[model samples]
Target: MNPLVSVIIPVHNGAHFLPDSLASVFAQEYRPIEVIVADDGSTDGSAEVAESFPGVRCLRLEKGGVSRARNLAVAASAGEWLAFLDADDRWFPRKLTEQVALGEACPEAGLVLCRVIHRFSVDIPEWFYGPTDGSAVTAYEPSAWLVRRAVFERVGGFDEARSLGEDTQWLSRAWDLGISHLVAEEIGLERHIHGANATGLIQNRRVVFDILRESVERKRARRAIR
Candidate 1:
């Protein structure tokens, strides 16, 4: 039997998209996996949408934020591996199969990430996704990751203080700690860049930069100590 994977989804007022996202996860259907939805205090029927799917554990939280929701869900999870999915994004049919294959092949790796397809509508600003057309192949999304539970614990939960780019901070910190990672060549996830998405908001982008700067300074300070 394959190892179990805990799929953690953080949702807030995402009723309109939960069905599709949940459907995508169930479509994988190739391995023993548990689905967990951390509902971040959504009043727009998001919890109901998540519950409609059989076997999905929905944790209704007090709108603390996505970071907090993820930490809480992880605390409740019982799998050796963890995969994160946002309510607005989805996974490809073979997302788990490919990730698990790579994980088993590289047992030493604590993290695995796959290429992603970013979809954007015409309303999104041209600067938001420069040079690339409607589709862009990118990395660094938490949704594209299949990380080990131990590695996640060592890195600690996401920075609850941050409302944006918490994933960036978490991944950066993991890398700084020298956690081994494996990359899957397949495009295993699709991130829909609707204008309402946080990454599209200019203010949120600033927060991402701040997180990056902090990571860089941490690295520099560590090098100085060496």
Candidate 2:
């Protein structure tokens, strides 16, 4: 039988958190999942850290954004499901197992997202849920979502053109394809936020988010026309 899931982790100057991230992935309660770590021209020791793992496959790419690195990783991996994780983030032991169970329970659900606990620099922790969650939520943490391998191919993987908001844009495309999504309220991912985080690029945040919104709106409009 094929593995139930594949985990992709993109590393760029990720030496600082690679150990914890790999540990979290290796500790996953679920078995039969392969972990693919892609290094995007990291000058630091990120590649070395990834090599320390027993069953990890590492890919090297030019210095592109996270999206490009992820695309390369996905192309190199072979699994039924694709689960993306940032090198700076960690996952709960049951994250993969819970997501797989959810997929099995809802055959129509093409994507499964779990709640994420975001630790900010101010020492404050915030919980982010999916769109179905109440208005109190802040934003959707893309890393919390698990997608089918077919969905990735259908959407052409992440837009390499996008330096940010890659996750939102990809999900928007999935929504257009009549993909159903399930959200788990349990804390399944931990996103460590710091100054060096790529998503924090202030100049790109607004533009990327706008692109994401437009992508989603276009999908909604298409659905209405259908």
Leading candidate by TM-score: 1
Instruction: Residues 15-94, candidate 1: write the lDDT tens digits.
Output: 99899899999999558999999999999999999999999999989999989999999999999899999998999999
Q: TM-scores of the models, in the given order?
A: 0.91, 0.84
Q: Give the least accurate 10-residue stretch of model 2, judged by summed lDDT.
A: 127-136
Best-fitting candidate, scored by lDDT: 1
Estimate candidate 1's RMSD in Å.
2.1
lDDT for position 4 in model 2: 63
Clash pairs of candidate 1?
Answer: none
- Model 2 TM-score is 0.84
lDDT of 2 at 127: 25
